[model samples]
Target chain A: MAKYLLLKHYRGAPAAVNDVPMDQWTPEEISAHVQYMNDFAARLEGTGEFVDAQALAPEGRWVRYDGEGRPPVTDGPFAETKDLIAGWMVIDVDSYERAVELAGELSAAPGAGGKPIHEWLEVRPFLTAPPTITE
Target chain B: MDEALLRSLTPSVLGILVRRGADFAAAEDAVQDALVEAVRVWPADPPRDPKGWLVTVAWRRFLDATRADAARRRREDLVDEEPAPGPAPAVDDTLQLYFLCAHPSLTPSSAVALTLRAVGGLTTRQIAQAYLVPEATMAQRISRAKRTVSGVRFDQPGDVATVLRVLYLVFNEGYSGDVDLAAEAIRLTRQLAAAIDHPEVAGLLALMLLHHARRATRTAPDGSLVPLAEQDRGRWDTASIAEGVEILQAALARDRLGEFQAQAAIAALHADAPTAEETDWVQIVEWYDELVRLTDSPVVRLNRAVAVGEADGPRAGLAALAALDDSLPRHAAVAAYLHERDGDLATAARLYAEAARKAPNLAERDHLTRQAARLNARRCR
Candidate 1:
């Protein structure tokens, strides 16, 4: 089975169709959205396609080595410019079509007024190890 | 407790239970229970005959579970005739188990998990840890695989190639968590080689050994990748290399060459060399040609280009690479190496950076990044 990553962006992605931020949404609508996302993951797990899903903190920094003994340089969280990933879900499915279908369903998660957000979720395929028969 | 001994006996014990009329899933569960018991009990009290002990215990567990289930009344007739518990017949059904675990119906990942659990005798948790998946996910994968293969009769002859492919996948997983999957793969392949007399099986075993011999030197103390040419040959396992070479020679003498045998021949040639500079790239290229003929896979052709580069010159290698699809995995990396060899430092540096971004894994990415950084630094100097 091939593994695919469905990435949710905190900042970098294009605006969703609904466009309303979570804080602006009604509490009931937020709960519904959360429930839908959870149900989606649970459904995938039941079908044995789910690998892992995780949420990332918005804050991040870029660090680089200054020298052998130096403490290293740290850049900002880059709140507005840099691509800040909100979270991701990893799924192992039988085909690219299945991956795409699931990603489409996930993108349909409800937003304000219990309507589909139609968010632009980035779908990336993981590069796998070369098969032994290759050698 | 002797974990290896227990694992070695696991398939045979499970096979006995299944042959004695227990269904595959139940038999496997019972065998796992027996193994768990062995781990818990055998530490204080060792069994006189481990396999016999396992068979008896696993069979009893299977019967108990069957009787406990109301829906399993259909299996009562099969369980009624329990043979006397004693030394298991020398009829090794492990090969059948291998085939079953690698059944065509299951996905490659499912097959791998099933083979590790049922054939490799690894616990679900262990397999989970090795695969970096949740134990529940791995458990479900294994159960699903077992369910998929449950309907297949045990007597049906299986494709050896499929079994080999599963083992090869396991081997290529390398090491993670507490399990060294490569060593386990070698052990399984060795077991398969003992069970069957196929030259390809021997070829696979030899190939694993040859690769494993150089494993220690493949990485540096800082956990960075070491290219083959830069590895310390003095530290390579000569014993393993010797054994691998011997096995490859015997397989080659048979003249019935398969893809594994051809690949092993290539590995053997690399092992035979005194140094990377002295490596018989011409012979390696010939083996790659044979591999291209056998598999016709673009990956093989990509690898062949690397060998061509070594055997002839950088220009020749680049010429060979020009014929293949550039989208192939490691294509950029190979192109970078050849360009670097051809003294096109600027092109090599750019390619190295591009390859680093496209690398499949962290280690390879880091290695390619370093290569790019090295070239960039050299150009600046």
Candidate 2:
């Protein structure tokens, strides 16, 4: 089985078909969106496809190595101002097609007015360890 | 009493119970109960025939379990056919057990967990601890696995390749918790080799032994990864090397030339060297060539590029690598190694850092990060 990461962007991604901001959506629509996302993860777990999923805070500072006996440098601009990652779900599935299908379903989570978001979720495969028998 | 000796008899004993008509789940549970009884009673009074003792005890447990459950009347039909057990039949059921555990229906994780529990004789708690999963999760996984294979007939032939894959997965897990999965894998593989006549089986056994021979030196005491070339050959297990080489020679003589045999040949070459400089890179590359021809997998090609670098030179290695995709795991690390060999330290350092950021596991990431840091420190001079 191959593992894939389905990435949701806060801003970098192209606009969704139902791209209303969460704050502007009706509270019922927001609840539906959250429920849809939760149900999707739960379904994946039941199918033994889920590896991990987490949301990012979208605010971080870049840190770098400084010379010995000196504090490390941390000076990048606010992470929130950039097109930052909102969340991601990692899934281990049988095939690339299956991964894509799951990602598509995830991207269809209800948005404003409780309608499909049609979001552009990034799907990236994880590099697996070499198998013992390649031949 | 010897715990390993007790565990070793587990699979055959379970096999006998299943062959005698106990359901797979019930048979496994009974065997576990019998193992527990052995641990409690054997220290005070050891049995002359441990296998016979376990068979007898476990069979009784199976009967008691079936008798207590009205729903298990399925076993009642076979009560008249109860085996008069002194020892299990001359026929080995261990191979069949391996096949059942690695049945095609189960997922790899389930197969692995089932094999460890039923074939490897590990407790759910022990398996859970080793895999870092909770006991309930592992128990559910194992039960699900057992249920999946329950319908498969005991006498049906199974794919040896699937069994080997499961064993190799176990071996690669190395040590976690108190269980040494690598050693356990070697034990199971050795058992499988004894049961089967396939060259690939022998080949897998040889590969495992060869890799295991150097396990002591694969990492420093602080748990840091050590590149193979930098490991102390003196720390290598000579006995395991000799055994592995002897096994590989026998399997090679079969001339089937399977993937595992080819891999073992590569491992044997590395083990043959007195020092890293003395390694036969030419022959190793030949083996990798054979591996690529057999599997045609990108991972094998990536490895072949490394062997090519050693056999030919860094430039030749880079040329070979050019044909491969950069997205492959370990691609960047291999490139970094080749670049360093070509005296392009800056590029090597940058690639090492990039690789570290993408590493799937913490240990590999730490190792790559250290490589970058080392190169950076040197450049500062």
**Interface CA RMSD of each prediction in angstroms:** 3.3, 5.2
True C-alpha contacts between chains kept, each model in order: 0.33, 0.02
DockQ of 2: 0.13
Model 2 chain B: lowest-lDDT 10 consecutive positions: B70-79
lDDT of 1 by residue, B231-254 (tens): 899999999999999998899899
Best by the TM-score measure: 1
Over the stretch A1-135, how does candidate 2's per-residue lDDT look in tens digits?
A: 556889999889998998888899999998898999899877776565666789997676889989999999998667456588889998766578999999899989998878899999999987554332221
List model 1 lDDT by residue over A79-111, tens digit each.
566577999999987688889999999999999
TM-score (C-alpha) between model 1 and the true structure: 0.90
User: Candidate 2 docking category?
Assistant: incorrect
> Residue B192 in model 1: shift from native, Å?
1.0
Check candidate 1 and list the clashing pairs: none
**Residue range with the least summed lDDT across 10 consecutive positions in model 1 chain B:** B70-79
